[model samples]
Target: MESAFTKYTPTEPQIPPMCITLTKFLTTRIQETYNVCKRENPTNIKNCLTNPFEARHNYGLDNERNELIVYRHDIIGTFNSFEGKEFSMSPYTISRYEVIEKLGQGTFGQVFKCYDHINNRFCALKILKNKKAYLRQGLLECATLSMLNTYFDSNNDRIVKMYDHFMYCDHLCISFELLNQNLYQYAKERRHIGLELNDIQKKLIQLLEAVECCSKAGIIHCDVKPENILMTENGELKLIDLGSSCFENYTLYSYIQSRHYRAPEVVFNNRYNNAIDMWSVGCIIAELFLGVPLFPADSEFDLIVRFVEMLGMPSDEIIKNGKIADRYFKLVKRTNKYRLKESFEFEWENNIKLPPHKNYLYYSSLHDVIMKNPMKLSLNTKENNFIIRECLLDLLQRILVYDPKERLTPNQALNHPFFTFKNINDITPKDFYEWTPPEREFPFKVYGHSVSADPEDMLSDAFENKIIINKKLTNSEYYNVFFTLLQAGHVANITIDNPFEYGSITPKQFIRVFNHQFSKPSIPKVSTDVPRSFVAQIYSVTDSFNSVPIKKEENPLTIKHCNQSKIIIHRMTDNK
Candidate 1:
């Protein structure tokens, strides 16, 4: 049998700096691996390390722990194949941890339910893919987790407790205390019928406290959705998946958060801060009650449209300030105000059609969605229902504001009436709750653009305020052809004089670009029936000009995506 004290060291000459912190961990794991391997396979211990998969099969019958040795050499130099970079789910001994089964997978990598031989407990071991980019993100998560766990939640109460982090071959492996299940799964189990008010309050209060703790640490959990929040064995909540988190001072990525919970500022690609997280909180709270997403949008375009339908058009200043504002809103030359481009206009621009059952097409307002929730019928009385609904609506309105500056902070939200547990005896229909809502404001100048104090035109019910497009423009005519060219500033002007002669023009005669300066810039008009070639050229010119690099900036205070799998790996604990 191989010596129980034998330690298999990596043949790779130069180890990366990231593995330096794992020296002590690696030493302990090597000792544990050999000891476990010797006990499990005394006759042919050496052969187990040679091929761990075969070892797993050999020991499957006898060894109850199903122990199989995994060495640094097994994973480090392995080439990625068509099957992909995932390690097998057999009871492989990754360091000192004995993998029981695969739990879940996400953008980073797969998670495994493992038994810690040294600690004599179960844990969720997150195995990041061996790619360098994933490695960097994994390191950031480890650093953030280390900071939060050691400095803030040493008791393992608020944030998910990271037991240990180390390098297993080229993969960055992080072991976390086993958690029960995520909040999403919790909600799903209930058929998304919405949680009871009492239960909702308890979870919301706990989650708010967690958010406040992170805020105090200057960390922005860029992703704060139902899936990332895990429930403890005691039924308490702990925020997980800090991989997307970054310090408020040094916001790394602009593109953050899931599409459903994304803040309006983030959607606009404008400067954002911790308030963005608060926006997500409001969405979550609403979902907890409604049993469905408040704003379930198909795309970014659909999302903005929903925002308008629910809240209304943002102040003209905000509309003008957004980086990609022009994509969704058109500046009315006469009014000098921004109008949300008609849904059909976006369809024309992107060449993608939206389904009829979009949320915006059904829901009239944000208030309407909340008030009409069927879950409220479960309340004992109309008075009780009214109190609960009013309190929630008031809180949500404050958090889901268009401007982040106007949105409630985590601390402030904790103090809101929604979190206040009122006695049922004190509740009376005559005594209604009322408080002055925070005045919407844009206090700071953005990109040399002054805040528009045009209160008269600030908010418009989008359902009532509709932009009529020409009836002659059919989807087929606009679908396969034509792009937009900017007629914003003084440049070369190519005006199609006669709409009737558009179809007769050949490909070469399509664009007659000449230096025809107008008294003022005009919004480019889409012809009813322009040839595809002419439309394409105009769009091509617009794209070239739009490609010019503009300065991109993030909020200095808190400014913190693609839909990765909703399942959270590190927090999956039900397999145990």
Candidate 2:
């Protein structure tokens, strides 16, 4: 995927004949608007260009002027489109576009690679799954894209371009410009060698820029993983998938984000905000450097333990405010009253040790973990490298804070030295230059279709369920081992305990056990730093709050309170 545009010799963007008419109308309309606005206020055009929230393009018949005028919205490059397009009966047919092949499927629905028959160009079509209730979600995506489309630069547009959307066969179909691939796939190819730190930083700049634009738009992209970011031929990054986005005025969904990118607030079911995205950004940035997920956990509890190992327990305010803190953390009254809960956890975890698991946080620190592992930080081993290592960790800490209120916003992040840093090593040797197709913008660069993708393909391959049948144990036998674990000073629901009572638990049964856990897990620490925010399409079903048929409580674990500091789970017996 090579660029097609070069300075003044930019490639002519592909547009259907009808779109040409719309473009003319839009251009005339914009000129008229500028003329009228300039007569009233001299700085109107400048404001329109600079004001990110300002409306960029408006399409309508100019009844006042007795003519139809359209102001073309030139995003990364220039693109022209017409609204209210009608498609044929075929699912693949959408106006003048023909479906090529299915590109991918996501939480929103299926995305197809399509060709614009009229323009002889390729585009992507997102066909909303036919659900009457999900129409609102489609509309939310429309609103978000509309806001993003107008906020554009010649080649600096961050979000994917949405050309048009329409209803067909009871399903909402959206047409977007076809992209090359995504960051996830791109990163996977080079995970072993990994991307240069400078290149990684550049990618973050593009992603964070998109994030900042969302903040300016007053929208939250609840999901912000590598899979959602597309990379173009010219190395342009575009953020896609807005089905879960919501406005700042209200939250739509409570349960949001994928397992790995999930913020502490999301895991705890606490009140969340834009900070959630920042935490994900931190995770993404680390992966870009390490070529793997920063914290890849088998279970949610394991992720919490990783946090404890790196950063220690979250602040007391985080624990208290968390909606489901009891599900993971055991809040014991302190014997040392003078020490704050957070301070005590940090100090005692680092100092005191009574047995095999006296304090969880004592296991390792951020420096120890990175120094032990093979990361970008581990590559540089000079004693003077502490400053650079701290620089990298400092950036991670700012974004991965437990309290969303304290997390670094995209605005603050862009100013951080990590993004602004210019490495001396970036300069290439005069004789050793890497050559490629010349950097030129393509005909489709700005109009339709989009960037690349970065999905976690290796995530599935990370674990192997290879049990060699070393011994055959009954369900009762498995339960007996767990019972013994509980009897020997093990705690259920604590981050330390593996809560799988049996060898198998269905998603429903797992949720049930998770909902019942007493000791809560603290938000994972980011080596002492992050917060997260989310915009939801539907936080939860309205009926989730309604009355339900009550059933006898299922006590999976029978525990007796030994005291405020201790509890005992009675062993399971093979009784007749």
lDDT of each: 0.56, 0.50
Q: Which stretches of candidate 2 lie over 4 Å from their true place?
A: 1-94, 152-156, 334-364, 376-387, 424-576
Superposed by TM-score, candidate 2 places the C-alpha of residue 363 at a distance from the truth, in angstroms, of: 9.0
Best candidate (score: TM-score): 1
Off by over 4 Å in 1: 1-95, 192-194, 353-357, 360-362, 376-383, 424-576
- Summed over model 2, clashes come to 56
Q: Which candidate tops lDDT?
A: 1
Across residues 24-92, which tens digit of lDDT does each residue of candidate 2 receive?
Answer: 545733554454445346454333221122332222222222111212221111122221122111212
* Clashes per candidate, residues 3 or more apart or on different chains: 3, 56
Per-residue alpha-carbon lDDT of candidate 1 for residues 1-576, written as tens digits (9 for 90 to 100)? 877897878764335332442454345344434544564565445533322333332212112223223422222211221111122111112335666666776777767777777668888888765544565566557545655675556577789988765544335567888998898888778753435666777888889878876766556798999998999888999999888876554455678999999998888888766677888989899887777787888788888888898898899888788898888999899998889998899889989897664543235587877776565223433446766677677788888999877787777776665665555325443333455433323232222111211211211211112122222322112111111111111111111221111221111101121123322122222222322111111113234311112122311000111111111111111111
How high a TM-score does candidate 1 get?
0.60
Superposed Cα deviation of residue 178, candidate 2 (Å): 1.2
